[model samples]
Target: MRAPGAALEVALQAHPDDGFLLLRTARGAGGRPQDVEITWANPTALRLLGARVAPPCRASDAMPPDVVSQWVARYEKAVTGPGRSWTNGVHGSSGHDATGSLYSAAFFPADDGVVVHLRAASHVMSALARDALHDPLTDLPNRRLLDEYLGMALTRIARHRHPVGVLFCDVDNLKWVNDRLGHAAGDRLLRHVARRIRAAVRDEDFVARFGGDEFVVVVQDLPDLEAVSALAERVLAAVRGDLTLDAVSLHAGVSIGVAVATEAMTAAQVLSRADSALYRAKRQGRGRTRAFDTALSREVDRRLTLEADLRQAIERQELELAYQPLFDLSSDTLAGVEALIRWRHPSGTVRLPGSFLDVAEETGLIVPICEWVLATACTAARGWVPAAGPRFKLHLNHAACHLGDGQMTAHVQAALDSSGLDPGRVVVEVTESQVLTDFDEAHTALSALRALGVGVALDDFGTGYSSLTRLQRLPVDVVKLDGSFIEHLEHRDRDRDVVRSVIDLSHSLHAAVVGEGIETDDQQRVLRDLGCDLGQGFHLARPVGAAQVSAML
Candidate 1:
C-alpha cells in the first residue's frame, strides 16, 4: 500500500475544487491543539492561496489573519474532539480572490489533520457590488457612479459627435421642510423626488443623487438646446406640487441649470457650467431653469473674483461707511443719516452695495460685514452733533438673513455699549419683504431690539405683498417708501395715491413716513406737500464720508 500522505496528495490532485491539507500542532499551554500547519494544497487551492508552497508551513503564513483564525479553530476541534466534520462561511482575503468574496469552507477530519474545500457565493458578491454604487436612501446612483456615467457620456460625445446635456437640479426649501417637519419626512420627500425625476426622464438618460437636495441628470444624443430645455421643464413640472407629509401640506420645487457638452470641454467643466446656470436660476427665483451661455460664463467668472476679493475687503480695511443724510421735510433740516457701506477697491474705483451685497449674503460674509458696519456707524455717530434735534438717528440697513436670529440684537447691543451711543438714537432698517418672509421669527427678533430702546424702520415698503392688517401689526417706528414709487412720483397718479395712502396709514399707526429716492425738486416738493415727515435722496445731499457729515452737522 502507498503511504497515507502520498495517497492523500493523489486524491487532492484529482479533485476539481480547491482543497487544502492542514496538520495539527502540539498544544502550547491549554489542553487543545495550538495551531494548524498547511502541509499540502492542490493547484486550484494554490491559486486561491496566492502561490505554490511546500508542506510544513504554518497556516498563519499562508492565509490572512482572519482566515487563518477561523481555519485554526476548526482544525483544533476536528483533531481534538470526536473527529466530526465542519462547514463555515468564510470571506476570501488572499491575492486572486480578495474582492471580499464569500466562500463556503468545509473541513473534514483526516488521519492527523483536516482537509478543506472552498466554493464561492456568486449571488452575495453581486449584491455587494450593487450596494457599492447605489444610494441607500433613494436607491439611485450615488456621486461616485454619477461621475463614472458622466465620463462615459463625455466619451460618447467625442466619438459620435453628438451633444450631451447635463442638468443640475437643486431642491428648494428642503431645509425649511427639515426644520419644520422631521428628518423622516425630509427623507421621504427626497425619495419621492428621486422617483419623480427618474420617471420624468427618458429610459436612456441617467439620473443620480449628487448630494443633499441636489441631483444630476446626464442625457446623451441630444440634438439641440431646445430639447435640453424641454427636458428641464419636464423635470420641473414633475417635481412641482403639494406634497402632504405627516398631515402637513408642503410645496415641492426645484431649480434646474443646464449645460451642453462642447467638444473641447472636460466632464468637470460641463458639470461646473451647469452648476453656474443653476445658481443663476436660483438668483432670478427658484422653480425655474436656466441655460449656460457665454455671457453667463463671463458673469460667473466676475462674480467668483468679486467673492474672493470681498472675503478680504473687511480685513484690509477697504470697507468704509458712506452717510446719506436723511432730512426732516417739515423743518427743512437734517434729521439723521442712513449709513451705506462702500468698498474702496484697490483699483481706485468705489463699489456700491448693489454691486456686491448679493454675493456677501450668499457667501455668509454679510454677518461679519454687518457687524463691522454696526460698530463703525455707532462709533462715527458718537462724534456727530445734530443740526437741530437733541441727537440725530443712525439708520443702518440689516440683511434679511441676519434678521429672525437673536444675533442681530446682540450685535446692536454690543455696538451701543462699545460706542456709548444712545440706543434711542439708533434705527435698524429692514425691507418689507424681509419682515413678511417669517413674521413670527422677525417679530421676536425686532421685539428684542425694541426692548433695547432701538427703533425699527421698514425700508422698501410697497414693493412686496403686505396687507393693511399685517402692516399695522408690525413693530415699525418709521416707514420708508420704496424708491420705485418715488421715481415717478411727480407724474404718476397711481404713485401719488399709493404714497398718499401709505403716509396716511403710517400716521394712523403713529409711525413716521419717509419718501425714498427723491431725485428731482418736483419729487421732493410733492413728498413734502403730501405730509411726508422725513426725506432721503440725491436731491438733498449725496452720501459722503464721516468728515463731510460732521461738517454738514
Candidate 2:
C-alpha cells in the first residue's frame, strides 16, 4: 500500500493550479518547529517556490526568513496535533518569497511529517491595490501613500526623539508651459523631474508626487537642521537643471518649503505649515526656499484675513479718499490735491493703501477700486470748484494695471461727464516704475488722456528706471520727485544735485517738477531755490477729509 505522503502527493498533483510540498519538522527549544525539511514536492510547488530542489531540502534554504518562520509553525501544528488534521489560511511572507506574492497556504498530515500547499492570492486584485498607492505616470508614491509614510515617520521620530524633515516642492511656471507647449510636453517634463529627484535623494528617503506640479519629500533621521537645508538645496538644484524633451532643450525650477518635524505636531499640522512656507517662497519670488516658522504662519493668516476684509471693504463702500493739498512754490498757495485711498475698517481703524493695496492688485480688485477712486476724486473736485474759488487740479495716482484696463478711458469720461468737472482739472499721476512695466501701453494711454485735455504726471520720477531720454519721450506734464530726494536735500549734496538736475530736466522737457515730502523749512527753501514748480508734504498740511480742505485753502 502507498504511504500517506504518496496518497497526498497524488491528490495534490490532481490540482495543478495549487502548489504542494511535503515537509519534515523537528521540535526545538520551547516545543517550537526549529527546522523544516522538504521531503517531497510537486512541479507546481517548485514553480511557486522559485526553487529547484530534491527531497530533504531545508525550508530555511528555500524561502525568505519570514516565510520559513511561518512554515515552521504550521508544520509543527499539522505534525504534532492530536487530530493531526490539515489546517488552512496560513500565508507566506515576501521576505523570502521570490515570487513577491501573497499566498493561500495550508498544511496536511503526511506519513513523514506534513504537506504544505500554496495558491497565489488574486494577482489582478493585488496589482490594483498597489496601483492606488502610487502615481501612474512616475510610479512614485501618491498623496494617499505620502500621508501614510509621513505618519509612520512622525511616530518613529516621536518615540526615538529623532527628527524628520519635510520638503514641499512646487514647479514654477508650470501652467505657462502646459498652456504654451501642450499637456504632453508638460507630462514629459514632470516625469523627468521625478527621475531627477529620485536620483538626488538617499535610498531610504521617501519622495512623492503631491498632485500636479507639486512634490513632497520626507528625510528620516536627520542629524541637524543644516542637513535638512542642504537636502532642500540639492533637490532644488537637481530639479531646476536643464532637461530635454523631444530633442528640444527646456528648463524648469522648483520652490522648496521646508518643515522640520516637531514632537507635538500632528501630520496635518506639519503639512499645513510646510504649505505656508511654500506660499512664502512663491511670494518672495519663485525658485527659492523658505522654512516654516510661527511668524511666517501668522503673517500668512493675517494676509488671508486682510484679503477677505478688503473684498468686503470694496463692496460695503468702506474705502474713503483723503486729500493731501499740493502747493505751488511760485504762488505759495494751494494748486491742487493728491487723492490718497484710506480704508475705514470695521474695527474703526483707518488703514493706509500700503496695508491692503497689494492684495487688491493681486486679486484684480484694483480695477474696480481704481474706477471708484477716479469717479470719487472727479466728483469731489467739482464740489470745491467755482464756490471755493478757482478750479484746483485733482491729482489721482495711477498704476500701470489701470492704464491697460479696457474700461479705463470710459470710466474717466463718465466721471468727467457726471461730475461736470473739466478734464483739464484732472491730473492722472503714474510712478516711473509703473510706466516701465509697459512703456508703450502707458504712453498710448497717457497720450489718449492728453488728447482728452487731462494732464499726466510721472510720479516718483528719480526712484525708477526713467532716464532723461525716456522721460522726454513720455507724454507727461509733470514729474513728482520722490520723497527721498527732498528728505535728504539739506544733508546730502548728491540728493540736492539730483533734485536740481531733475527740476532742470523737467523744465527742459516742458514738464513741471513737484518736490514731494517737504516736511521742514530748510527742505522748502532748498526746493524753492531749485525752482521746483510744486511741493506737497505734511509740513504744509497732512492728508485730510474733503470737509477739512476748505479750512486748508
Alpha-carbon TM-score of each model against the true structure: 0.77, 0.60
Top-lDDT candidate index: 1
Per-residue CA lDDT of model 2 for 225-289, tens digit only, reads 67887998998888887766667676778998998885757778788778888978987878989
Worst 10 residues of 1 by lDDT: 87-96
Task: For model 2, give the 10-residue run with minimal summed lDDT.
Answer: 88-97
lDDT of 1 by residue, 1-553 (tens): 1133643565566654544555556335355544567766655565555533555577667666766677767666655565353333222222224455445555666665566655455534666888999999999999889998898778876678889899999998887778788789899999989998999999999999999999999998779778998999999999999999999998998999999986756778899999999999997879999999889989989988999999888789999999999999988888899999999999999999999999999888998998999999999998784453674789999888878767899999999999998899999999988987778778888888899999999999988878777888888899999999999999999999989998999999999998889899999899999999999999999999988988887
lDDT of 1 at 531: 97
Q: Judged by lDDT against the true structure, how good is candidate 2?
A: 0.81
What TM-score does candidate 1 get on C-alpha atoms?
A: 0.77
